[model samples]
Target: MAKFFKYKTTADLEAENARLNLDLRFSDDLSPLSQPVTVGTRTVGNRWCIHPMEGCDGNLDGTPGELTFRRYQRFGGGGAKLIWGEACAVNDEGRANPRQIALNPRTRDEFAKLVEQTRQAHRDSLGDDSDLLFGLQLTHSGRYSVKPIIATHDPLLDPRTVVNKATGQKVTADYPIITDDELKRLVDDYVATAKLAVEVGFDFLDVKQCHRYLLNELLGARNRPGPYGGSFENRTRLAREIFTALKAVVPSNVLLATRMNGFDSIPYHKGDNDDGQPDPWTAPLANGWGMSESDPFTPDLAEPIRWVQEMRTLGVDLVNVALGNPYAQPHFGRPFEYPPPDGYESPEHPLTGVDRHFKCAEAVQRANPGLAIVGTGYSYLQEFFPQAGAANVRDGRITFVGVGRASLAQPDWVKQLQDNGKMDRKRVCRTFSYCTALMREKNHPLGQYPTGCPPFDKEAYGEIWKEVLELKVKK
Candidate 1:
């Protein structure tokens, strides 16, 4: 019998402290959550993956430093079947944050060390039996770059860490529109980086295709041109190109995944044109993509067997579904958007219908084999995934389900479910959205977000705590 503790109420706790003072009960009648599943030949060290959360990779001169290695290793060692090393930039201009880890050959040694630290942390803590896998969710912030020097369709993206593209110096990025050569280089960089991950000892690489990224911006009918603009095929071509390039350089042994908005299924901005671009200079700030309160634009986009089927054809191992609208923070899926006082608990929360999304993937699988779908939208509600997936698989529906935010709060979340019979039993992850505000650095991005626990970081984000205190998870 697992013990239970409830001294603290489920309130505004930080991500690190979200899962504290909890207990579990297993039942013979209630089927166990299931066991470690396979991602190809590789068995997840545990089902709960510490989903790709972002942070500076602590690079000094385009190379990772010891401090960065220690930080990630600590998180990796804390335990996870897989850990995404933030959103690594594929090329220089594609970089969003100046310190984000880049997979370029220029930083190979640092990455190699990072790989070593990941394995070392897992081996030291859990022993040889644990095969802690690592994947890189490579991204090109495109128009939504954190660097003020970089230009995009909408210029309001918080310019906290502006980067000087030429020298890679920490300068203000300007509205520098990219050219054809730059786009090709971006594709090439993705291919080269995919190869680099294998060489550096990482397991998989997720070619990021969602949010308001370079590709997304092009595909979204914003400021794009030629064949890459018109139909969905045109829009999706870049993703296919990048993935195809990755497959060529990266071996069949490596797992390739992508985090994309399965559909732009949300309502469009009323004032803006049908495309949801919003007025670049005059419209309200929230009129654009994520700026809208309407459900995520991509959620409404789930359609045509073509998009899903193509993912399978593109050598994609997995697609982590996400909302490309307001759901993605200023930097694309950072922090988190909240509604009123009690947000996560909004009656609309959790998407009243998760099965529909699974159905879309199912339709795709019929045409394309071997492509696995893993996702639960980085929610702290970890158990909801497997419990739902277990039933889905029984009905020939879902093969895998991903749990992101919860895993960050508790890395061994999967183990807890395996050891105990039920997932709801564990009492951690108040889901207070502390991690959200910290991640967003919401007070206009000048490094205002809280990183660990606010109380834990007096020097970092105590003021940010004031905003966090306003919200509650509404468990």
Candidate 2:
């Protein structure tokens, strides 16, 4: 078990970090974090960034409800210069959850109002909006779509679909794969969504490719037989076309971006070992993107580097790096002490997971210095996040240190850092995984649940948790 994050003092934290051969450092001034950076034609106020975190509480028609509005409003007031707004589906059928927000004709006005509310809240709290940038993450949950209309069937992702719970026997489902014609239509939907985002006053639009969404899955579609699969160019054709179409419609000031999965690890099982390591498999690695073809555990940055160079040419602002899919390989992307209800114990130390993300960010930043790179997997550091984050920014290993779950647990952590250069240890994220557990529980196609910091905002999610536990006990 990891003991370093439990330390109360900087001295003890530093001692543990040194023992682990980690070069974490802290500063009282926080000058590096407060420094302004420029992307595209705009200048951001500071280096702190809030990664996109979904609330899963939108209206049935995919409009922002009160909970969704409140979540973004708090994030705005938290003082992150660059806020990557949560993922919103481009169409109804592509939604991952029934309540997932969608940018469409009916919900356009509501989304525009939500953007204004978020910006005004930031201005009211922080006193200025001159350097703030908000980007909307647009996605199509192809394989994970709750609707049966536009689902994808990848051999690597959807093989042996049915599993008997009691006997653990595998069986296949007869789901049809998404056709190439549908992909072309998806391109149009993306372009139209981009136009709506720009009209709604967003500074940028993120074509989300992380966490095994449609585009990310397409990146690794080696077995599919179509114009959009097999070779590298064929696989990446959709993203390039989407960019071209978006650039043609949107104004030059509207920046294009992507939150991408930079690496993936082999799947693990609980019974693999007593220590929670992955089981040995003679089966070759699946057609997952960003991993070495021969060695799935190691990163193969050749394609990612090439994609970065291509993105620069296509006017992409930046790429936020997340590793693996939360459904299949949760630990690689989210380093948590506790696992969600459906998750297995972590196969490696949480610090090792954090280190892998840092290394991936370093490799991408080193290869493509011009294209900004935001690093994730830092929230596990708790109060020590600032020390390691500041060190990475100062050394130019990454452009921005992103806060995902931490933002929920402590929305005002940035303000605290700005005010005193130290955080109240009590408020720091403990990696409890309650937020993730709630998400997994309320992920049904008809479930309308709100996601937030249960421990901090006990009035809402805490009560929900109690009800959940009661139901569990009754079961």
Candidate 3:
């Protein structure tokens, strides 16, 4: 309802933010975005980072095809120093979708070629690859998996996320909890995947722990017993073990990183009654992660600070900070004016959502200034993104400004900013979330590949959406 992009100047935006009781900042000069920063041993050329966004365009067998190659090539040539590549399942059973990319002996060599070509493209455009950092995010989809192998039977997400909108029934008839022994096997899988990444020539490997994936789910496992759940140490056991094992095998130069969820809001439903805010419970909220148990919505960064300190001690090069799961609470993660197919409306102004992200990420950065932190939620700012991003980076609030959907919408955003010193409002993302809408529709029978900006790439995704709308829901 705020319609932030309507404001033309930083002062106008600041006035609006103040009126809303929001803590936000913006700088007219965007030169801070072009400044170089170091992560562990690597010196990145700029503060812009391309956050990993998977294109469901891989081969059925999980190999990178022409579309996948083209996407990375564009990102490399797009002028972001740090390219945080999209999630690639360590194994098949853990895949979120059938088309999700996976790393293995069969696909390792091809992934290597993909990485090489992307770097070559970067070199060709930027004239230097010395400070470029490329990372591959390896993950297990967990509760949202096509397999439905979950870490814990999360009461909040179980019923809501399992049902397919089309059929109004559970996709996986049997919802099974993954055992500690299976988790140990997953550790081996991660180590194996890390080894493959090193051979494939990645600068770092992201042991992904955000967005309610298997590992992130495990972090909030307060009920499940054994070495992999219950206590805080137990909940974090998998990530700690994976890092320790991986470091021993991979060469010293290959860095380790993670994309972490700073906080999680409650799952939102689509209805007139749904305000898109957390529902009040009886005092202590159950199964909450990164939030006060007493007040499920307000952030409690104590544990998250400890988690960052632990990562720093474990020698993590950087941590890309994100918030909420796109599947359950899309608005908090990616504030959009128009929701996805089965999504709820925004409960608060998009600026409030942006403020929450900045505050949470800044908390982590303040606690561990040495740990390079990549900030999300800037894409919702539209043309004013660079101004806010520059202000935050200059103030030491975040190390890098990570752009996800905006990068997909306009690949040459950073390059244009560098050349013209201003973002083209026409090409800027309006937060319509057409990309995510396409991603959600893949659950339906007539859905096409889940990638590209439908608003921008009308020929491909928009046309497919037309056919998708004509098909009947499975139920």
| Index of the highest-TM-score prediction | 3
- Residue 319 lDDT in candidate 2: 86
State residue 279's C-alpha deviation in candidate 2, in Å. 6.1
TM-score of 2: 0.93
List ranges where model 3 is wrong by over 4 Å: 1-5, 163-175, 273-283, 443-448, 459-462, 469-475
Candidate 1 structure, TM-score to reference: 0.69
lDDT of 3 at 221: 77
RMSD of each: 9.2, 2.8, 2.4
lDDT by residue (243-292, candidate 3, tens digit) is 88887897877889999888875777665664565543554545657987
Instruction: For residues 287-389, write the lDDT of model 2, one tens digit per residue.
Output: 6678765687788878877887888888898789889888777888998887767777777767778888898888899998766789998898887888778
Tens-digit per-residue lDDT, 328-351, candidate 1:
222123222232121222222222
lDDT of 1: 0.52
RMSD of 3: 2.4
Give Cα-based local distance difference scores for all models.
Answer: 0.52, 0.80, 0.83
Sort all candidates by lDDT, best to worst: 3, 2, 1
lDDT of 3 at 248: 86
Q: For each candidate, what TM-score against the reference?
A: 0.69, 0.93, 0.94
